[model samples]
Every structure is written in C-alpha cells, then in structure tokens.
Target chain A: MQGTVSVLTQIKEDAVATPVDRLVAATAPDMARVNELILSRAQSHVDMVPELARYLIDSGGKRLRPMLTVASAMLFGKGTGNAINFAAAVEFMHNATLLHDDVVDESDMRRGKPAARMIWGNKASILVGDFLLGQAFMMMVETGDIVSLGVLSSASAVMAEGEVLQLAKTGDVSTSPADYSEVIRAKTAVLFEAACQVGAISGGADTAGRQALSQYGLELGIAFQLVDDVLDYGGQAGTLGKNTGDDLREGKMTLPVILALAEGTAEERETITTALGDPDATADQVSAVVAIMNRYRALSRTLDQARVHARAAQRALEALPASDMQTLLADVVEYSVSRAY
Target chain B: MQGTVSVLTQIKEDAVATPVDRLVAATAPDMARVNELILSRAQSHVDMVPELARYLIDSGGKRLRPMLTVASAMLFGKGTGNAINFAAAVEFMHNATLLHDDVVDESDMRRGKPAARMIWGNKASILVGDFLLGQAFMMMVETGDIVSLGVLSSASAVMAEGEVLQLAKTGDVSTSPADYSEVIRAKTAVLFEAACQVGAISGGADTAGRQALSQYGLELGIAFQLVDDVLDYGGQAGTLGKNTGDDLREGKMTLPVILALAEGTAEERETITTALGDPDATADQVSAVVAIMNRYRALSRTLDQARVHARAAQRALEALPASDMQTLLADVVEYSVSRAY
Candidate 1:
C-alpha cells in the first residue's frame, strides 16, 4: 500500500511540473470555438438524422483529442477555423477510434459503463464508428488547408497500418519496445502530431516550428500512453476505472509488464510470462504480475522513461514564441504526466 | 431458356445504350486529375500503409463517386485540384462505408473476395476504415474550401445516422418506402451530393452552378441507388458480382422490396415478411421472395422511378455550359438507370 502511494505521489508531481496547464490554458479561444462547433455541428446532425447520432456524440468523453488539436494550433501563434475544424475532427476521429476499439477489444466495459459494443452490438458500433470517421474526414476537407489535410491523412493511414500490425502481433510475447513504439505511434501519436502540425502550419510557423510541435505531440502521446498503461497496474480504484491490472488479465504486453518480464527473477519472469501466455489468466495472476513489476521497480523505470519523454516534449515548446498559448501548452505537458491511472 | 436469353439480350442493350460511356469519356480530364490526387495525396498512406490499404482499394469498385465529383467540377468550367481532392475524398468516404458495411452485414464477403472484416478480422478492418476516414478529413482540410467541407461533414453525419436508422429498423416489416429512401439518401446519396458539390465549389462554379451540380448529384445518387436495387433482383451475373436476392437474405428493405411488400398478394407478402424475420432463412426462401417480387413487377416500377430521377438529374445538368464534361455528366444520369447489378 505504501509503495503504491509513493508511485501515485510521484505521478502527481511530474504532471504539474510546468508545460501542460499553460498549453491547455492558452487554448481558450479554440476551446470556445470547439464548444460552438460541437453544439452547432452535432445539432445539425440531429436535425438531419435525429437522435441516434446525438446519443453517440453526447456520450461522455473528456474531449482530450480535440483539446490537444486546438492547443497545438494555438501554440503555432494565432487561431483560425482550420484549427477549430481540426479540433472537432480530431475529437470525432478519437471517438470513432473508441467505438471501434471497444468492438475490437471485445471489451464489455469502458469507463464505468457497458461499452458501446456491448449495448449497441459489434455491428452497430463498428458501422457507427465508420460514419463518425466519415464525418471527421468531411470536417477536415472543409478546412481547405492542403498541408494540414495531407498530414492528417498520412497520419490516419499510418495509424491504420499500425493497428493492423498490432492485430497481427496480438497474443505474441516476443514484441519489442521498438515495435511497441511503432504501433503506438501509428495508433495514438500520429493524430497528436497531426494536431500539433496543423496548428503550427495554420499559425504560420516556419518549418522548424511545425517540426518542433510535431515532435512535442509525438513524444507526449507516447508518454501519455505509457502513463495510461502504467495506470492499469499502478492506479487506485477511482483512476483505474475497472480492475487494477485489467490489461494483464487481458494478456496485454504493456510497458511495465514487458519491462518486468525482461528484468524480474527467473521464477518471477516465468510466472509473468506464463500469465501473458494464458489468455484465461485470472485476476490473481494479473495482480501477481503487478506485484512482480513493483518488485523489480519496473513501473518506476517506465515512469522514469515517460518523464524523460515528457521533458523532451516540453523542451520542444521552447522554440515557440512565449505567449499565453505557449505557456498553457507547456502546462499541459505537466498535466499529461500527472494522471496516474 | 428463352426467357434467360431475352433477359441477357436486354442486359446487353442496357450496357450499350445511353450516356454512361460518353459520360466516362467526357469526365476523363477531371478523372485524370482524380487519379493524380490519389497518387499524390494518398502518396504517404499508399507508401507507408501500402500493405494494409492496398487490399481494399485494389478491390473492384466503379469509382462512380469520384466521377460524380470530377464531372460536377468540369461542368462548372473549373478544373482545379479542389475537384480532384473532392473526388478522392468521396472515394475514400465510399470505401470507408463499404468496410464498415461488410462488418455490419457480417457476410464475410464483398465483390466475391473475402471481406476486409473476414480476411483481416473485424479489428483491422474497422480501424483501417477509420484511418481512411481521417485521411479524407485531412484531405478536405487541405483543400481550404470551408463550404465544401461543411457539406462533406454534414453528409458524413447524415450517412452515419442513416446506418443507425437502418440498424434500428432492420428486420422490421413495417419500414416505409420513405424511410428506406432516407436510408439510401443518408448512406449512399449524401456522398454523391458531396462529390458533385465539392467539384463545383473547387472548379470555381458560381453559386448557381454549385446548386445545380448539387441537385444533379442528389438525383443521380438516388437514381443510381434505385437502379442498383432493381439490378439486385434482375441484373446480369456478368456485371453484378453478387448472387441475386442477397438483400432479401440480409433482410434489407430497398425500394423494390419495399414496394413489393406494399403491393404483393397476401400469401406472397407473408412469405417475404417471414423470410425477413428469419435471418437464417434458406436459399429457397430467398428465391421465393425474389419470385414474389418478380410477380409484383417491383423492379419495373423501381426502374421507372429510377428513370424519372435520372431525367431530373439530367435536368440539373442543363445549367452548365455546353462542354464534353457537361455532356458526360448528363450521360452518367442515363447510365445510372441502365447499370447492371
């Protein structure tokens, strides 16, 4: 219990250190625009088709992806509708991803409720996700920014390829960190980079500025995902949502677990690897793996790496002109590391 | 045998007759631009995700949506990258729809090949489709046509809602023809409308030209879809890849099926209504339903309606100045009616 407390304490510190909150705060204008777009655009959908889509749109999510998009755009300097569209587009894309992810994961639960796949069925979830994706694309097209469109499209393609690669690699225990990064980059970070890059381009940043924001987003996305994975084992009841160590029970090879398997004692490694091999591993087995991970301080090591990436992400923002947007964008970096679960 | 030959002869005549061939020829220039955009815009995706995305894209498709976009643009006397992007965007949207459609239908098939969901698993298929959707939004953003983007996004939302509506109404015998048309418009025609609307906007068409092309697409899309339903029952095997009565097997309610359900004899209606309820109904039941539809001359009625829509679509073309592209677009209207299964 003491050990878990220390881990949680450390996460909170890292998350509030600097960049994240500022970045988030600086995106105020974009946020307002996003609210307008969400209300107006979603209401328009309700007008045309009514009810069904509104249910999915209104379903609760933190709207993290869209915020990231707007923040990234603002950090580039000024603001525009392209960023607004990017924000909404990213959010729509994220939601579409979630709907499909729930189906693919065959996860019956998400947050504290039954997954959309469970309530709506895999078929409805999948098709509705497709429709949302179509909506996302259409939003992007309306932005009329070729560079922005090009980057996002390429990101999307990479994201899908990465997803397919991960699917092909599922249930395999021999996956490497490099492979995992490649997969996550496509699955999670491309959009992050696209959001930032789109923002930078719209802000009239030079090539260097765009590249820096893109780098920041890429690294931050990886760090965010790493922290999220770590939370699967390390989080408390509230933050973790479902069961602690749920990812292991599902035979997921997340960072700490993977690192622990590499560094743990022979017996510990065997048990952990065995659980990964067994798709039907119980919660006890997952918890056992979690304990072993803690013993090796694998979670700490993973956190250390995430912090390093987060710092790098923060540093990338140094190139941007100092402004309220820049400060808020920077603060977001800190906040990103703070969510333990 | 005589009846089959006569039908085959009619199919041959349909293929040869009307404006589709001429339309394809006229739209060649803009379509060429569409091809260029595919190579350039989808360059990164095709390069990075070639292995994953090539499978579906290379699969046989008519490229009709893209043609609508290019044709609409050319009709307005503006041949620019906007039209090309719009064309590519529509194609991307169309493919995304098909990917999800196969997943929802659970048929494990598409155009005779194993469905993406079947071959790659639902997870990969679903995610990749999403990636394409993002790619499309990115394309729209790059185009910098806010109005067109709005149109595309709106269509995307409507399309999703349409699918959800269909899902909700599936296997329910009381689904009205109006509701069925709603589904067709949302799921299919919206893309067509966007394709043409984008084309006109990108091609520098005046407001009048844009409105005309938009109307043309709306009508053409409806006509095309109506004709498609008719072909599902009576189209030649050589052209329409799937077996006849597939829609009936799936319990879908297209216009012919809906009209037949409305007009058929009590006994005939009961047989179809029963088959619609039983998802596992036998091949013989499917055949029986088709026979009942034939007895009701449902396809004839549907064909007549399609012709009317085709003429209406052609009327929209009259706003365009005389050009090969305009003529070809008009040709597409006639071709839509005559397209075999």
Candidate 2:
C-alpha cells in the first residue's frame, strides 16, 4: 500500500507540463481544423439546434477522444487529411452520447456547467444530439471511407447498448466487476477504440498497425474510465467539474463501488445501500461511504487496475515503429491514469 | 361549401376497399422480406434494445414508408435486392424518430397503445432509439451504397431540424402557414422523399427517373402529412389510432391550427389558446376547437391543399413509363387524401 501511494505521489509531483498538454500542443494544427469542422457542422437552420449544440460543444471537455484520433493519425508517417473528418466525427459521437446520457441520468452539471438538457430542456437536447449524430455520419460519408464509417457506426450502436445495460444495472448493488467492465467497455472504451482505429485507417495503416492502435485505444479507454470511476469517488469538485460521489448518487455500478460492495461487512453494506441511488443523500453520507471504500482500499485497487490497463496500452505501442509521436502517445496513456491521483 | 361537403361524402361512400389495401397486397412479397430484415436487424445482445424496439416495430403503423420504398423500386422494373436493405433502414429511421419524438412530446399514446417511453421509461426509449438509428446506418453501410446512405443521413439531419423547429413553434399561435409547411416538409416529407429516391437509385433508375420518383415522393409525403394533420382534428379516434386533437393537446402547429388561428375571431382564438397544450383538457374543449375549425373551413382547406399535392404526386409519376404499378401508386395518392373523409 505504501509503495502504491508513493508511485502515485511521484507521478503527480513530477508532472508540470503533462503529456496531455504536450499531446495537445503536438496536435494543435490538426485539432484546429477538427474544431473548425465541428463548429461548422453544428450549425443548423433551426436556431435552437445550434444554440443547444454549441452550448454543449463549447463547454470545456478535454476533447480527449478527438485528440487521440489526431495523435494516432500523426503517429503514422502517411499524412492523409481524411483523419480530420474522422476525428470530428468521433467527437460528435462522444458529444451525442453525453447529451443523451445526461438526459437519461438526469444529471445537472457537465464540465462544471449546467448540462445541455438542463438549459434547453430534454426535448431540444435529444433533437440536437440526434442532429449532431446525423451530421457526424454525413461528414463520415463525405470522406468516402466506408471502412472507417463501419467502425464508428458499429461503435455508436455498442455505446447505446452500453448505456442501456448501465441503466438496467443502476442501483443494483449486486452488480459484478464483470458487469462494470462490460458497461464501461460498451459505453466508453468502444468509442475510444473506434476513434483510434478510424484514425489509423485514414492514415493508411496496415492491418497490423490498425490492430495495434486499436488495442492501444481499447486499453487506454479502459484505464481512462477506471480512473474516472475513481475520481467520481475521490477527486475534488474543482478539478472534476462534477461533484464527488456522483457515481454512488446516480447508482452507477463503477469499479470502486463494486469492489467496496464485495468486501464490505454487513453494516458497511447497509451504509452504502441506503445512500445508493438516493438523489438527496447528504455530503456526510457520501463521505461515510467513501470512508468505507477507503477501509476496503477500493479506490486504490481501482487505480491499480487502471495502471494495469495503462501499461497494456503502452505495450500495444511497442508493436509499431518507434517515433516521437509513439513515445508521446505512451506518455498520454500514463498521464490518463496518473492524473486521477 | 356545399360542393366541398358533397365531394368528401361521395369519396367516403365510394370507397369499399381502399387503395392502401390494394397497394399493400401489391407489395406483400417485398414487404415480407423487409419485415424479416427489420426484425433481424433490431436484434441486439442487449435484451432491452430488442424488447423496446420490437414493441414499437410490431405496433400497427401501416409501415407506409418502407412500403413506398419497395413499391418505388419495383417501378423501375429492375429487381435489385439492395432495396430490401434500404427499405428496412428507412423503417428503422422512422421508428427511431418515433421513439425520440414520444420522449420529446411526453406522448402518452402511440398507435392507440401506451408509448414505449411509458412502458420502458424515457431513458430506455432514448437509448433504444439511438441504437435503432445506429443499426439503421449499419444496414445502409452494408449495402455499400454511399449515394443512398448520403440521402438518408441528410434526411435525418433535416428531420431533426424540423422537429426542433416544430418544438420551438409549439403553442405559439402566431406561427404562420409557411412555418407549418416547413415543419411538415422537414419532419415528415423529407424521409418520404429519401425512401423513394434511394429505392429508385437501387433499382437502376436513370437520372430522370430518379428525379421523377423523388418529386413524386416529396409531393406524396406532403399530402400524407397534410391529411394526417387534418385527421388529428377531424378524423375518428378509432380510425386514427391516436386521439383526435392530440396535436392540439401537444401544442403542435399543424395546418388546421395554423389556418384556424389565422382566420378565427378574437373570441374563437381565446377558446383555442385555453385548450391548446392543456393536457387535461376535456373532450368537450377539443370538440369546441374542432367546431371553430369547421366554421373557418380550416380542416377542409387543409384537405384541399392535400388534394393539390396528391395530384402533383400523380403528375410526377407521368414522367415514368406507364405500368400497372404506376396506376396503383396514383390511386394510392388519391386514397391518402380521400381516406381522411
């Protein structure tokens, strides 16, 4: 436990200019074009469509998914411009899911601001999310890359299924670790996998290169989500832009909760079960649950699991030729897990 | 006024077996294959997806859009099986929108049954709708017909815009006839146009043939929605599946409401404003609004407009080679308007 804590502290203390910052700088030009495309495509003749779409789009998400797409494309020496469309499309898909997920979860804050559904009403949110998806496909079609479209479209379906499965499992205290993995894979990691794969395809990756990037993406996505689950229980509100313990309040069966539930005594289990899915649960109640999670080392265990995936993500890159982009990509994967500390 | 009433009565009395029944019989074999594809495509590893999708798909909505797709493909006399995929994709798109629309409108009844949202909850409905849409795109991608995919994706964006525009205009009595036309064209007719256009393209239609079929579909779709709008105010609940005045209760600015609001006296306008969007409005309140609509000939005028578009649809078919399908299709258009009587 001391070793694990020291490793996390070392990673945090050593970071001044993080890999994400470097990656963002490395991919700024391509991302500029991607950003332009996203804003341009979000425009609609209906005033409310753009209004709601921009409200969410311009909100400060890390834009990590599209950045991954751009970075992956850059890793390949072949400079195909089609990655621009693919990257924008991937971001649109992510935003579309976020809009719908917020509505489904009845969440209030996104990126430290009121959610799109909260501002525009669920009807507008649903419609604009739909419009963005349609535009995403339209942009994909315009690129004439049927293979990339297939990857993304299939990912879109899997993501929705993941959300449905998550909804079904919400508040189910008996939800297993396996169920949580399946939920996050479907809802989160699949898009990440698709984004990287599509980027590799656009950059003229061979079958092996595509497969390598896809594996990297899948592992990185898992690590990213595991860390997110940890943050939902352990991170600060200022950094998260969302309140801590949101997963517990929403009854999301994330890794930490699943771990704690599995190890908790009967009394600790009672403490969690009472607060789980209780929208009005007090801050003190949430802290009590978090304390129980600490008692079981659930949060740290989840981070340990994240580190495993992050290492796997780094290993995926070893299959490719060594390049500066590859090293940065590896660092980005490490940063994804480390930042949660 | 007397002549208009007699014409409506004569059309009603002359109809024994409607043209829709004949059209359905004509397309039964193609429709069988489409139904099979739709059912198979709706399947998912996620149990709730199929459950909710099947509930809506199996509901009795006449499957008119897909039927049109099949019938249009048959008109070209080249039997390309790709139409089967396009037809199924079209229906999936239609069903997806219906799911989202029900959530947006907070609709209680759909096809004379409880809405999918009511049974499955809004979260499930929204996610399942998204899953259906993704499946729809996957089906289109499977066909490798980028042209058809382009058509459907663009129509999807347009339809969403239409829905948002209509939502914005809801309960706003100042909404104009032009606004009503734009709303229905975007929300309803665009899909109709795409269904036929894709079918014609798949059937090896020449440029002229494709344009003709596209025009025919657009006009027919306009007529279809106009008749539907009138039915929401003037048709019987038993025949319409949904209740008469559902549009009114939902604050929809359909043609009848637009026309009546435009022409009604101040007192009559007051009567409508009170009941419009009042979910708890009694049948008596609805009847009073219907009576006002009659006094202004709003419903009749709307039907007259539908007749004009229905005739234009038949004219568009004149550009094609004469065949049995053409004649039946023409009768189908006539029946679309006359059935409302």
Candidate 3:
C-alpha cells in the first residue's frame, strides 16, 4: 500500500499536463493495489465464493471507486497509506454491491459478460456477495479507524435503503426527479462520497476538505449514473451487459424517461408511458420511447444537467493543490458524463 | 450471552447425572466470556448492523455455538483466549446466515414475531445480513486462529452451496435422497461441526477429540434439521415461526417426503406429484400433500431417523470428560428432536 502511494505521489510530481495521463498515473497504482487485495483475499477458497467472485472481478470493469479514493487523498498529497487501503476497501464494497444487485435485479449480464448470479445462481451470488461485504468491513476495521467504519457503514445502509425504495417504486411512471436524486444519493453517490471522504481522512485533511471531496464525489456519481441511464437508450445493447430496454422491461424508471414524462410534449410523454407501462413492453415500443425523447431533446437536456454537475465536481477539485492527481480528479468529472458504449 | 450460557450450563448440570458436573463447571467461565464477547461485538453497532442484530439476538435463541466452544475447552482442559473467540465467531457466522435466510425464505415471523425482512424489507435484511457476515470475518481475524478461520470460511461456503442446491431442487419431487443429504450437510451440519471442531482447537484437543466433537455436532445438526422438517409438517406454526406447510408451499422436498415418495403406494406417490409437481400448486394442493404424507407415515418415519442420529450424537460425546456443558450437549440432541409443538 505504501509503495502504491509513493507511485501516486511520483505521478503527481512528474506529470500534471493532460487530464487523462495525469489521472492514469495517479490512479493506476491505487487500482493495482486494490486488484491485488481482491485477488489474494478472494483466492483463499474455490468452492463457491471465490469461483463466483473470479467470474465477476475478472470481467472487465474500470476501477472507478479506487480512482476516486486516490484522487481524494491527493487533495493533500498522493503519498498516503490511508488512501491506498481505503481505495481497496471501496472497490470491495462496490463489487459486493454488484454481486447482490445482480441477484436482486435477476440480471443475467454485466460488464459484457454473464452476471455472477447468471453463472453461479442467485444463491451463490448472494452468499459470495455477503462474503465480500464481510471482507470489506474487516478491511475497514484493520485501519483501526472508527470514523471510516462509521462513514462506510452509514453509506452502505443508505444504499440498501435506496434499493428498497426503488423496489417499492418499480413499474410506477410517476418517479420524480427528486426521487431519482434520492435513489442516486443513496445507491450511488453515498459510496462515491465515502470513497473521497475516506481519502481526505487519510490525507490528514480537515472536515471542510473531507466535505468538499465528498460533495465532489457525490456529484460525479450522480453525473455518472445519469450518463448510464442515457446510454441505456443510445448505447449498443450487447455491450451494456443487458438488453437496452431492460429498465423498461424490468420496470426500472431511470432519469431520461422521467424527464421526458415530466416535460416532453404530450405525444412523446404518451409514447414514454406506453413503453414503461407495459410490463412486457416490446423492443419496438422501447425504441419508440427512446426516439420520442430524442425528438424533444429530453435526453440531451438531461445530459446537459449531468455535465453541469460534472463541472461542479471539477470546480470542487480546483481547491486542491495543483498536481497530477488533482488534474485527474478534474478529468474524471468530464469522463463521468462523456462515457461511451 | 454470558448470563444465558451460565444459566443453560446450570440447567445442563442439573439435568445430567453427577458424571458430567465437573465438565460443565469447568467450561462455564470460558462460555461466559465468549458469550459476553459475542454479545458485545454483535450488539456494538447502534445503527444498521447492531440494530438488526439486537432484533434477532434478543428475540430468543439458544447460544449453542458459544456453549460448544466452552465445553470443548473444558473437556480438553486447555486455557487460552482463542477458544472463547472462536465460540463467539461461529455464532456470528450463524447469525449472518440467519439474516440472509429470512430474506430468501420471505419469512415473516422469527421467534414468534415479524422477521427482520418483515419489518425492514428484504433489501435491508439482505444488506444487514451482508454487514453481519463481514463483522463475523472481522471478529474472526482478531483471534489470529487460522485453523478456525479456515473451518468457518469453508463451512460458510458450503452452507451457501447447499442453499443454492436446495433452491435448484425446489418444486421438484424427483430429487434424490442423496442430493437431499448433501444439501442438508452443507446447509446445517457443516456449521455445527465447525463450531465444535473449532472448540477442539481452542481446547488443545488432539485429533481424536476434535474428530469426536466434529462428528457429534454433525450428527446433532442432522437430527436438528430432521426435527425441523417434522415440525414443519405438523407442528404448531406459532412454535415454528412459520406456517406448517411452508416447505410444500415453497416447493421444498425434505427427507420424509423424499423417503415416502420413493416407496409409497402408487396412489400416494401420484398424490405427492399432483400436490408438489405443478409450478403453481395451490394451498389446497399443499394440504392434500400433507395429508398424503400423514397416510404414508412420513413424519413418524422421519422422526425415527432423527432419533437415531440424536442417539449417535450422545454416543459421540462419550470421550469427553464429564461436565455440565457436555450433558447439555447430550440433551440438546434430544431436545432439538423433541421440540415438536
């Protein structure tokens, strides 16, 4: 972890030019350590948990959480032990959530491969997910940092609660933007905020620094989620890991449709409702709904809002010292919304 | 936990003959400590994890794992801190399983009241279950007892595998008895065996002592599960915290029904098929199945096998020194079976 931190610090010193290069340099070591911990801890047994976890972890995924942790820590300095451990911890928690999410959603694909539940069965996915969550909590305890434990636990609880709320709201087309925001805050932003805040703590930053990083992460996460929702319509179905209209098929009311229903012309809103209202809504219907959103620029408008939040995330990081990690943090804000299929 | 364990130990002493008094008295202190440690650790979190734990722990349960830990220590006469910790560790693992189970089973009642999922929803139950599992791992790491960790982890993994297997077999009357046994061993017996075997490690028991305890716990667990199946068939729902026909309703094939289906008269087998075969079998159909089970004496025959296993468990305890905890262990075998409401 220390070596990883040193590499991050070196990146900050050597290159502060392009956002992508600086970001890659700052986050690569942290991501490597996170992956190492995951591989080592997850390899102890091959019976079920390890087998199932390997199927998912090996599935291609960008190490977003660890990057945020490293970036947050770099707000002060990159060479911090706390930052590296927390990075690993956040990734563990995120992976655990993914495992459970697949089971709950009855999803069959993720990250361009069959989901853990699809391959291992819901039972294996659920149990292995539990195992990983336990592992994450253990990691947090190892830091002997009570505040970190408190923050992470609270965030996890909120995440689960948001899931419950979402479950209750399924199939309802009346999902408001506020409700969408709450769900994102609980399900997505909380962890993002926690990752950054934990980084701040590791860097010996004050409460204000912690809050700023947390806000930055929260905004970034929301923007990321918005883009994901947008891509569900615009991106190719095969690569997104599920059917493009899965949200409609599974009764998931994401932001793009919600905005269209609220503000689109009546014909477009009707089109959106027709697709969302049908439990077994067809691809053509879903495509029609997407086309209607395009016609009214509802999808584009939502992207604009996401970009605003992304810019806010960048401005928040501007308070940090000029360094490669800081530059990377700013770059991630843009990347969050500029994601491609 | 200490209070509960000591009270139970006194009951064991009073229940057993003079032969077992010394063992119980000797084991009481460690059990007491383990109970305290587990309770403190389990209930320490005031929010998510602790809140859910208290709901279940205070709901009334026999702290069997901690008792096993202490008894093994006393029987082996090894004084070390590790044993008590293992005792607590096993219980934590057990509780983690329970939390997830309630969610999966969609059980409303636990210990005569609404279950964790009933009050908090499946999502909370699932997430909190994740939290407890993680906490257990955290606590286990504290002991630095690798053997115990390996045992707990393996048992946990197998338990999950068993659950998955059981799920696969649901609503299928053609499930073989061997498959049922495998599921049973994975789901229940492994943990019981693990709890006792880890106790042996703490007690400084030789290979023979550990093997005896391990086998004893395994047999006891089988008996316990058999009894549970029996109760599920005809016992009072109030006592069971679930409806009598929950298994049939949930499409589970237990030992009794499996045994009966293989050998019952053709008419009875047809009845079993009609009641359990259809994917959408109704409540009336389930009642018919239970009636058929009665005609075939499935409950009686199953109870007899359970009794045999209980007797085997008692015999397995012979090598251990006479003690109150030991007597309680013997009585537990009988008590679990005789628990029919």
Candidate 2 vs candidate 3, DockQ winner: 2
Give the least accurate 10-residue stretch of model 2 chain B, judged by summed lDDT. B1-10
- Off-target runs (Cα >4 Å) in candidate 1 are A1-33, A44-61, A68-86, A134-155, A194-214, A235-242, A249-251, A261-274, A277-279, A319-332, B1-49, B73-82, B139-147, B201-204, B235-242, B323-325
- lDDT at position B153, candidate 1: 74
Best by lDDT: 2
Chain B TM-score against the true chain B, each candidate: 0.87, 0.92, 0.84
My TM-score estimates for the predictions, one after another, are: 0.82, 0.94, 0.64
Cα-based lDDT at residue A75, candidate 3 = 66
Query: What is the C-alpha lDDT profile of model 1 across A6-53, one tens digit per residue?
Result: 433454456553444333344555677876776555543323232334
Ranking of all candidate structures by their DockQ, best first? 2, 1, 3
- Model 3, residue pairs in steric clash: A134-B134, B20-B323, B23-B323, B24-B323, B24-B324
Best of the two (2, 3) by lDDT = 2
TM-score leaderboard ranking: 2, 1, 3
Residue A269 in candidate 3, Cα distance off native in Å: 3.1
State the C-alpha lDDT per candidate: 0.71, 0.87, 0.71
The fnat of each candidate, in order, is 0.65, 0.84, 0.04
Stretches > 4 Å off in candidate 3? A1-22, A44-48, A70-86, A142-144, A202-209, A235-244, A265-267, A277-284, A294-296, B1-186, B189-223, B226-334
Q: Give lDDT tens digits, candidate 2, residues A1-341.
A: 23323433454456686888777767777788999999999998889998898888899488999988887887774324889999999999899888998999999989889898888898988998899999999999998888888899899889999999999999998889998999999999999999999888888889999999999999999999999888888642213233877888898888888888899999999999999999988888888888888888888889999999999999999989987678888989988887786
